[model samples]
Target: MLTNRQRNHIDVPTLTAVLVLMVLSLGVVYSASASWAYEKFGTSSRLLNSHLIKVLLGIGAMFVGMMLPYKIYQRLTKPALIAALVFLGITLVLGGEMKGATRWLHFGGMSFQPSEFAKFALLFHLCALVSTKQELMKDFKRGFIPVMIWVGLVSVFVLAQPNFSAGVMILALSIVVLYVGCARLSHLFLAAAAMLPVIAVYVLMAPYRRERIMMFLDGHSNGKPNYQLLQGIIGFGNGGLFGVGPGESRQRDFFLPESYGDFVFSIVGEEYGLIGTVLFMGLFLFIMLRGFRIAKYAQDDFGRLLALAITSTVTLYALVNASVALGILPTTGQPMPFVSYGGSSLIFSSFAIGVLLNISAFTDMHPREQKHGGQLSEAATRAAASDFGETSARPRPEGFVELSRDARPEGSVEPLNRAAGRQAGVGTVY
Candidate 1:
């Protein structure tokens, strides 16, 4: 039911970049998984077929996300977060384990990753909580602690699955969001200090976790990296200037672990070369900047925070995945968002992007022309003005903030109220 006319309201560049990455995933995932899939399933097409199905489903979900009002998620936050928590708990208790960790839920003959859903649920809820409690954010107990309780709960649940990387990423992302939402830096620092001991214990409680850290610290027995990382580095090195060409990777024959999933960037590097890798990373960079553009023009505080959270999560995961492949960090099992071959990551991330595009629809930061792309139709424009009227009405995801022209200097546009100087990200919402 989606059409090009409907897409005119969304951020075309970000959406285009996402589609490009998804399309690229088809080739990259197939190349990365072909050998392993053949050896494991007696056919190379098994994983490719599954990944293609997920990609198609992800695209559909993204469109659905674009059509829905993002505020609807605000109303659904409590229930959605509760459901996420329940699913995560169920996964921890009854989920299948692999490689000494449990991170998936099995139902109706399908495997789902609850952490993927959980992190986003937590993000939405936190945005709501922060927006609603802006007046109290500076109050440690009433504001900061209450917000942090959810973060800690979700992180603890994730860590209980023995997923240190996800747990840390959730915690770090939550902190960043809170900071952007105008929480006190001192409060963030205090909380981080308090959690260090707990984090240390979590790391030390598991032999493998401790070993991975030690390996990275000790340089894996006197300046050597882990085998997987070493092989991944080799893949990049072999790529030289212009890659070995698609599907011509030497690492795909059971050399780099999770070649299609965690270390898919290696396959890209090996096959497409440094030029290809940089170009691949350039897409995420574009996404990161465009997400900020959306946030800067978001109709409300909640939309700003959500855009920030969604963008940061995807791009940070990509950065970490690339870092691990380059042997600059320990392997953390992070997938490269749209580029990785996974059902849950691709689906949830695509949907989150949809929500972001929905927010973008309310802003002027759309395609450059009214006739060609992203113009607010006259009916929609009237509706947006009505939704945010006469400096009295509250902004929604369907409308943007209108700054007082008098307060800004000549030839300059002030994004937020001058009074909200430090709380730029928290503008007009609290």
Candidate 2:
């Protein structure tokens, strides 16, 4: 049912970039999962098959997200957010435990993590609220509290599940979004001051969390080199300049736990060496640049915020995962986006990118022929502006930001299809 009928409208390069990661993930996943699978299940490909199926299913989710009108998601934002909260509540009541934390729900032989979906549902809904409520963002009571309430609720639920790091990351991501939406800096600073102590207490109060913190602070606290962290570092050290070669990771042979999951980056380093690791890291950097460019040229404020939030969220998680694997940060159970073995994260992340691509499809970056494919026209450059939006292949001036369709200083709206009614001062806050 899903096809690429509107490929010309979307950002092909972004799509291809993600696809390359997913494809290469197949081999890396198999290499990392082989020993674990054979030890647990009599076969080496069990986890590989599982990861591959998730990748395929994620592709389908991506197409669905790409083909549908991104505006529809705005209309569905409220209900989607409510549904995510309900699912999170359900998870707490009846969810499976791993690593001593409750975060996943199994249904009909498939596992789902409500927090993954909640993270983006909160983001989409946040973008909706922030874009429409820009006028009120500077007010602490009227604007800030209302938006922060949603963020606080989702984060509380995640933390109650005992997922401290994810809860903190979700909260941090929302704060960044609020800051970018131009919420008053004073209010954010005051609010964070109030929350910092609570967060510190919460982290220190948990015995297990405290242990992890101590272990991170003192790797020899228990007189060992932090088994997991040391193994991961050894993986990187095994490959000095080049690599030990593909599928030749000694760490994967039961030395590193969950090599195909949270620590997959270490397996990558061990097998591909520094050259391949940098190339892999470079891909993420490239994706970030491309994502920001799309946001810069989005058709509207909501589109701009959505594109940036999604891209930044994925990149942040990837950064955290890699940092943990390299022992640069304390172990956080977050998986590498697209590359780690998981179902919910891959699907949700892919769907979010699909929406971003849909945003790009309406921008000047879209490859469609303006006067038949070569030149630019007014409509072709509508995503651009003298301000927040892009003007051409070249960049915009220094300090301009997003402008609402209803607030364009020129007081003109696009006289075309969707832009006519929607851009003609009609609000998009359905």
- Scored against the true structure, residue 316 in model 1 reaches a CA lDDT of 93
Which residue runs does candidate 2 get wrong by more than 4 Å? Answer: 1-6, 367-369, 372-376, 380-430
Task: Give the TM-scores of the predictions, in the order they appear.
Answer: 0.86, 0.88
- Tens-place lDDT per residue, model 2, 1-430, is 2235345668888888899999989989999999889989999999999999999999999888887778778778889999999999999999999867889999989999999999999999988877655655666777788788898899999999989988988988898788777777788888799889989999988887877887788885556567898999999999777999999999999999999989999999999999978877887888898899888777666888898899899889989999998888999899888999999999999999889888877666654345645656655445434344344434433322454234432223222233333443433222
Task: Please report the TM-score between candidate 2 and the true structure.
Answer: 0.88
RMSD of 2: 5.4
lDDT of the candidates, in the order given: 0.82, 0.82
Per the 3 Å backbone cut-off, how many clashing residue pairs does candidate 2 have? 1
